[model samples]
Target: MTSPILLTGGTGTLGRHVVPLLRDAGCEVRVLSRRAHQPVEGVQYATGDLLKGEGIESAVDGAEVVLHLAGDAKNDEVTTRNLVRVASQAGVRHVVYISVIAADRVPLGYFRAKLGAERAVSESGVPWTTLRAAQFHDLVLTVLGKMTKLPVVPAPGAVRLQPVDSREVAARLVELTLDKPAGLVPDLAGPKVYSMPDLVRSYLRVRGQRKPLVPVPMPGKVGRVYRAGGNLTLEGADLGERTWEDFLAERVR
Candidate 1:
């Protein structure tokens, strides 16, 4: 019998899409979660906390491939380090990591943590592949939804985002998880880029609401990076088919 594949972040936005695909591909899956869950057919739950370094050894045991999708705004490096250490000890064959576009270039705590996690995976002694993707449509929608609640939306000047569908990203990650390890694959981004105001306008249009948009200039090094498109993959990147408009059409309403 083939060993089961280990999956982290198995209950997250991306993981929800990945689990069914992996199951349909005829692979048994073990999902690591902080909370307990009843096992389903071909899928088992391993209770673990990557940040606290608890239950990882048992989670990784006997798994050949690990798809690490769990992450947070902070401490991703520490969590990934903990997972890789156990994965190495377990003699896991491959470690697949999903990161954000321009993780190294973006000057933020979250981006820095992601970059650190990438380093941990690469140096883990296990064969590895990392794919950087743009912000998910779900995340973008949440941000815009909050902004729309305000009387006047604050649009960060010169800030742009290419929001890709989480399902598309999940599909690509499943393919990578099933294939041989390939290091640092080309980035994946949404087909179209939209400015902050454009995104806000689109959201308003979808919701049939009108509100004034206040242009707010982003300042300092972080602002400079965003203005220069440090958070973007403009060239040599795999583009997802779903547009932000397509996502809004389906989700908002």
Candidate 2:
């Protein structure tokens, strides 16, 4: 029988979906979080952090595989190194990491961090699979929360994104966790790519807020990549079923 599966970032967006699927598959699930929490039916929670490497060994102990999903998008490289060190020491077999698409292309800090994290995981000497996917529709919501106040929204004009559903991405991660570690996989993306201005407008319309959109050209090489469709997969590899519109309409509630 497979040992319990250890999932980092279990309280975050992707892990919220992944935990249930693991349970549905009859795999024992353990989650590492910094806060104390009550246990779910088939899940256990342990307090931890990716920065300081706290509560890591106890989290991975007795687990057959580690879904190393914990990391700040800003400092993912450091987090990945810490987790890899701990998981390597714990003698865990397989590790499945959720990374962003085109991490190597964009010159943004966060994307660079993700690329650094991927390198750390790959060099950890542990059996590992790193899967990169397009941004999630929820990312738009996050952007809105950060950029918009009430009636005004400032964002990039030509930014193109292929946003996938978090649940579907989580499903793919669960599949990777159970399979043999296959190294870096092809990009997973939404059925269609949409511009940022259009997507944000659609979101605002749905939320009953038709805020005036100020399309400012984001300043940097990363902004250039955003304008050049760096976030999209040209070969149309592993297209997930949800469109940006479909995601906003159905899942945003």
Candidate 3:
């Protein structure tokens, strides 16, 4: 029997999509999460905390491939380092990591953490594959939802975003996890890029609401980086088919 593939962040938005796909491909999956879950066919749950470095050895033991999808707004570097150390010690064959596009270019703490996580994966002395993807449609929607709640929505000036569908990213990740380790594959982004105001306008139109949009200038190095499109990958990147309009049409009432 083939060994089960260990998956971190199996309970997250991306991991939720990946687990079913891996199972459909005739692969046993072990999901390492912080919480316990009810039993499911062809899927096993391993309760562990990557940040606290607990129960990782048992989670990684006997797993040939480790699909690490777990991440957060902070502490991703520390969590990834913990996972890499255990996976390395377990002799895991392949370690697949999902990162954000321009993780190294963006001058933010979150981006720095992501880049640090990437380094941890690459320097783990194990075969690894990393794929950087643009912001997810779900995340964009969440941010827009919160911003639009305010009386006047604040749109960052000269900032644009390419929000890809999570399903498409999940499919690509599963393919990489199944294949050999190909270090730093092409970036994945949405088909179209939308300025901050345009994105806000679309959200307002979808919800049949109107609000004043104030253009807020992003300041300092982060602003300059965003204005220069540091968070984007225009060429030599794989684009997803779904657009923000398509996502809003389906998700919004």
Candidate 4:
């Protein structure tokens, strides 16, 4: 059997795609879930909880690679530190983590936790690779949905973003697992940049909702950062064919 790969968050939006890709690559995949479920053809489910540090050692015992992708934003730092400690003890050869782009750069609560997690992964004794990617298309879609339902469609002033498809991100993740650890790879972003109002309009056009867009400035330092393109990777690498429009067209209608 090939070296075992243990994936956390294997049932998530991106993980769902990665599990199959790894299996197709002839890897023995073990996923850490909270409860037991019928196993897939070549996959094993290990019961574990990062928050409580339960079942982690057993999960990491024999796996050569550990893909750390599970964690709630609120407590990601705790999860990451715990996972790293166990993976180091387990002698895992390679640890790969998925992170959002500018996790350290962004001051959002979740981003701060992600930055801490990244720090943990970097300091883990095991070899590791961290891929920081742009926000997922589904997230942008959610924002659009919320904006359209508001009393007025107010857009963040000059706020720009580059959203990538989660599946494409998953494919890159699988590719990284196959190669030697390269530390931090280039930031992954969408092919194009988009303004908030434009994205909302694109979403509205697809949904057949006609609404007037009221452009407004986002308050606070976070807003200022976004307005200045803090959340964007205009010069980063990209690996997604499905645009925000493409995702909406396919999924919304």
The true-versus-predicted C-alpha distance at residue 252 of model 2, in Å, is: 5.3
RMSD of each: 0.7, 1.8, 0.8, 1.4
lDDT per residue (tens digit) for residues 129-183 in model 4: 9999999998888878887997689987578888999889999999998888889
Q: Cα deviation in Å at residue 153, candidate 4?
A: 2.2
Score residue 116 of candidate 2 by CA lDDT.
Answer: 96
Better of 3 and 4 by lDDT: 3
Q: Please list the residue runs of candidate 2 whose C-alpha ends up more than 4 Å from where it truly belongs after superposition.
A: 145-150, 251-253
- The Cα error of candidate 1 at residue 124, in Å, is 0.8
List runs of model 4 lying over 4 Å from the truth: none
lDDT of 3 by residue, 86-180 (tens): 99999999999999999999989899999999999999999999999999999999999999999999999789999999999999999999999
Query: Could you give candidate 1's per-residue lDDT for residues 112-216 as a string of tens digits?
Result: 999999999999999999999999999999999998999999999789999999999999999999999999999999999999999999999999999999999
| Tens digits of per-residue lDDT for model 2, 183-229 | 99888888887787877777777777767888788777767777787
Worst 10 residues of 2 by lDDT: 144-153
Best by lDDT: 1
Tell me the TM-score of each prediction against the true structure.
0.99, 0.92, 0.99, 0.96
Full-model lDDT for every candidate: 0.96, 0.84, 0.95, 0.87
Candidate 1 vs candidate 3: the lDDT winner is 1
**Candidate 4 global lDDT:** 0.87
